[model samples]
Target: MNITLKPTPEIILTGDRATGPLHLGHYVGSLKQRVFLQSQHEQTILVADMQGLTDNAHNPAKVSSNILNVVADYLAVGINTEQTTICLQSQLPALAELTMYYSNLVSIARLERNPTVKAEIQSKGFERAIPAGFLTYPISQAADITAFNATLIPVGDDQLPMLEQTNEIVRKINHLANKKVLNECRPLLSNAPRLPSTDGKNKMSKTMGNTINLGASEKEISAAVKAMYTDPNHLRVQDPGQVEGNIVFTYLDAFHSDKDYVEQLKSQYRRGGLGDGTTKKILEECLQSLLGPIRNKRAEYLNDKAQLMAILKQGSQAAKEKTEKTLFDVKAVFGLNIL
Candidate 1:
């Protein structure tokens, strides 16, 4: 996979909601890429607690408690706190100020038209009583990127529309404010953004009970991998199976060390003699090899919770200092500075 080279180190904005422990789907889909990008770009990973609260507003404790869990996930996955700034979104006041300004730039109808938000609303069954905060989160995300003056946003394909909306706000704000304060952001769309659940559902979600947490115990991971859904039609060990839709093969494609082995397995399965047990065992071994280090790192953080919190606090402070400067400039542009 070729990473596009920027003329200078481009600023990047990427993050996850702190609703639960980061899962395998999260690692393969985005975090793994993020770990690599930190060395090449100016990256900031936001623990999006503020956004998580949009839907879970009634559960403040859930959002607060998981902030560190999400940070731990970041650290365990090799997102170096020294190289990448990881911050809590709610701690940055500039984001709210920028979100407010961007809100005015975007119409309510435009927010309604965002495909990502629309799909989420329908999936969550919040059709009629959509929370206002939830409805405007794309704007908040716009605030997130522009506050950092980020030039690239790593997001899933489903979030392409949200990036479009953010760019629209950037363009509008730049024109209206009569300054090119906000940079137009390009979407770094992941090749496999939406990893399906082991059950072969369209998405792997914590709420859907289809996720393998990054911090899951060896036993837990073994159980989950054992029960993973494979090609249902391949009922017998001798029956020829289709590897195209097999979730186990998908995991292999995403995480395996030897592509040759995966290809051999696929060919054998397609040719009619590969047992599902054999294929699954291969996948389990490949995945365990990949996740073992991450699990160990997570355990270390879990054992030393105080040190983890200190890292988060340090990162959050650094992030706020940068964001505060941007907010001051934005306020000056709008003539809203009171002091």
Candidate 2:
């Protein structure tokens, strides 16, 4: 009689698309959490170059160029390579294989019904001519999660549907296997609220020119803060200000160290004594201090591209071993493991 050992139950898998340099929104939403989680759990951070290509297939350079930038951003935010396995998605053949197998379990209509997918398709204006890859990337994401047996995935509220889809695949795989071949995962939702774009019109987006990158220079940071959206109704400093939608206070609430002080400012602004310039000045100072060291460290990492590539190569090797084992098990269950 043989008894198989279950994979570790606390592994975490998360990543970013290699589309652009990361921004404060990424830091608050997931990067900061990644830093803390690396030490507590077995974490794998994939630079998702393949997924980044779902929409950028016409411009592959957009994804290829930012692979190192994403990794540098990871290192800058204190994601120690020693603790977190940072691998390039395109380097992991097992993940692609797993994605191929998982794809059979999902259908086009099901993918179309995915709210996240629908929203993305509408936003990208891919309505009728949506790339097959873009429509099916959720299945690929499911493969990424299960390949490492990840049990905790860091995500924002908007991403819960993606995880729901992942677990749906998990259930199908396990049901087909007649045993626990895959582990169901949960979302480690961030406590931080979504950081709005500096313009206050949408979520922070790299394409919109509305975000302050993690690698932003001091001058750029100052300009972005100065241009932050504030209450249009408050034309005078003496007029009562609205704190609810003001981008300055929203940023302060997100980044400033002193919560009590931010609340005080909110109260003062509501009563008509505080000026938007004063709030923007303080927010700028807070952001400058927070991002200054990160910018320097990121530059240091990018300066050594050879070392960065080596790090990714080593991680991909380790990840290959793990994911290959999973692939073997899944295939064996499907009676397709003749190799």
lDDT (C-alpha, whole model) for all candidates: 0.86, 0.92
Give candidate 1 misplaced runs (Cα > 4 Å).
1-7
Query: What is the clash tally of candidate 1?
Result: 0
Best by lDDT: 2
lDDT of 2 by residue, 41-103 (tens): 899999999999999999999999999998999999899988999998998888889889889
> What TM-score quantifies how close candidate 2 is to the native fold?
0.95
Model 2's alpha-carbon lDDT is 0.92
Q: List the residue pairs that clash in candidate 2.
A: none
Best by TM-score: 2
User: Deviation in angstroms for 170 in model 1?
Assistant: 1.4
Clashes of 2: 0
lDDT of 1: 0.86
How does each model score on TM-score?
0.95, 0.95
